[model samples]
Target: MSLTVDIQFKRSSKIYHQGPISLINQSVEVTKSGKIPPGQTEIPFELPLSPRSSSKTLYETYHGLYVIVQYSLRCDIKRSLLAKDVSKLQEFIVEYRPSNGETDEKKAVKFEIRPETLQNVRDRARIPQFLVRGHLDSAVFPLSKPLTGELTVCECERGISSIELQLVRVETCGSAEGHTKEASEIQNIQIGEGDVCRGMAIPVYMVFPRLFTCATTIAPNFKIEFELSIVIIFDNDHLVVETFPIKLTRN
Candidate 1:
């Protein structure tokens, strides 16, 4: 069976001060899969940084900017079984580019902000609308094996002005029983403010498992269903959340 995976980044807020708001750079890739080329799919481009006039703050902001990124992935399984196990995919990379006549290959600056520093600007640095899309293929897997994949956002830099990482949340759902209640939480490793320097990319990775364990005894001809969603929050109030769907059929 054929499966499709869709990914998107949407920014919901912005606070630009003492600088021009141009483009928001983003990239996506399938770093790992059970039977397909891991790093073969990529979509790199920029989104216009057009914020509503009402979304701006009037403070003497040291770093008056915020953004949010949302991402999602979906897949299909050709075979169904009473019980199955899934493994986490590995890391993927994402980077940002400035439109001020800079090279796309420019290195990113690293900065880490303390929790206290982030708390000060948490309300001001909100992400408004950042989104991107892509897909993955799972046609080569055998009935005994399942399809798995991973996606990640690389470190993003905004010149001398620093961007902060605030919060990250992920959710999943599907036709399979209790699939919606499966929550895998990652421990947040706090990086100090200004630690991620300008022109550099911060990497966040998400691994996807291909198999779903059956909730009860079932027939061999029945189908198994699944869905997944990921949400990321930045200091600037920007948020990115994407959802993916998958189905396992009887062979």
Candidate 2:
């Protein structure tokens, strides 16, 4: 039997990120005869989790639209010429160890969305008068905790069709020569539908998805960042967006 651990990095067609690096590859002898008997057999083995060299470092496993980090194990069984070789591959997750660093004070953010605060408006007179008030409990969030906040529609001349919270992942991959950055939506959750009541507080809550997200990472060659967008769609299908950049940590 053999064990192998490989880390693969790939780029999209439009010159993104590409490369597959092997961290560990080793052959292990499980049986004296190098053969297995009939029906059912159980074998137990243990291997140290370490990189092949001192220079190589393991990164957290992440699945993104254009960039991905993955760790996998493979076991191969050799057979006679009459039979074909058999192999099995299993994927595993890797994460950074939580640090005991000092915690930062939680900072709450208050925001108001008005027509004047909107951007890229071709004609301000076309937009209905509206006011929105909200606050995020904290600008920095731990991966294990849910994002909590509240928003209220203070006043609006036009009816609202829906209000949604969007989580976006901004992935940047490149080297010293250049880099490519792309933003993709990880999830969209609706907080309000139809005409919502004025002066009523609508709670904001979102759980960071597993595998699709990790602690905000910054490396020389790549970066994994996150942001949030609050989308409000009016009855006429016109929409306005407010974006917020957030920091993530493992506490």
Candidate 3:
């Protein structure tokens, strides 16, 4: 038995589509191009990657209603010619959001999480003892600006032990067939632990990179979503997580 591996940057149609179309913008294969025996895999291996002159490296991984700009690595295992072969495909992401540098734009963005908003996770039969709420100072921020907000935790059993904030970009792509979805992290920060007491208020601040990150957008093939996630961890091992979606456009 033997194995071969390859990585590729490509624009491809969703799976299951008849006559699927794909453009292999770039591909890099391991230099050791022989069906090396599995037993010989003890040696280290390195592969070179290069893009075509006309090909463009991804600015942002996009999932469109009909297509996807996908980055993937594939591994193929081969055995006797009469035997069947096996292959595996893994998808990855590229992100381009930069950090808050210097910008004069300042705008306020507020998010309200009422009890009703927490219904999906909260048991309707039992009342929740705590509520997690927060709001960013600005709805639209440059990468250089801190995503500043105030967090309030209404707790009945002491206060929350930890608070976490993250900026994420979610993309979905597919058609009449099926769909593939991916979420990439733009920025994440743990606000660290605080006093475990009721009525705890914490001010949040963090910045995301601006390199390849772009403003929020939607298309038939895919949509880019930005969100702030608040996680409340308790000393008792219970968890409360809330997500507040936001627009990442400039003022």
Question: TM-score winner among the candidates?
Answer: 2
Q: Of 1 and 3, which scores higher on lDDT? A: 3
Tens-digit lDDT track of model 3 for 1-251: 12222222222432344333232433344444456656646644443334444433333444433334455566665557797987777765655556456654655655555446664664443334656555678666654456787877654444456667877766555455555566666666888576444456678887766443555656444456677777666556555567767666543
Candidate 3 segments exceeding 4 Å error: 1-107, 111-116, 122-128, 175-179, 184-186, 194-200
Ranking the candidates on lDDT from highest down gives 2, 3, 1
In candidate 3, how many Å is residue 129 off? 1.0
Q: Which has the better TM-score: candidate 1, or candidate 3?
A: 3
lDDT, candidate 3, residue 20? Answer: 31
TM-score ranking, best first = 2, 3, 1
- For candidate 1, write residues 1-251 as lDDT tens digits: 11111122222222211222212223333333344447785434333333235423111101101111212122233223663644333222222222245322322222233223233333444433222222223322222334333222334432122222222222232222322322332222222233233333344322322222211112121222233333344554453434344332222
Q: To one decimal, what is the Cα RMSD in angstroms of model 1 from the true structure?
A: 23.7
Whole-model Cα lDDT of every candidate shown, in order: 0.28, 0.83, 0.55
Q: Please list the residue runs of candidate 2 whose C-alpha ends up more than 4 Å from where it truly belongs after superposition.
A: 1-17, 23-27, 52-56, 122-125
Q: Give the range where candidate 3 is weakest over 10 consecutive residues by summed lDDT.
A: 1-10
Pairs of residues at least 3 apart in sequence or in different chains that clash in candidate 2: 11-17
Ten residues in sequence with the least summed lDDT for candidate 2:
7-16
Q: State TM-scores per candidate.
A: 0.23, 0.89, 0.52
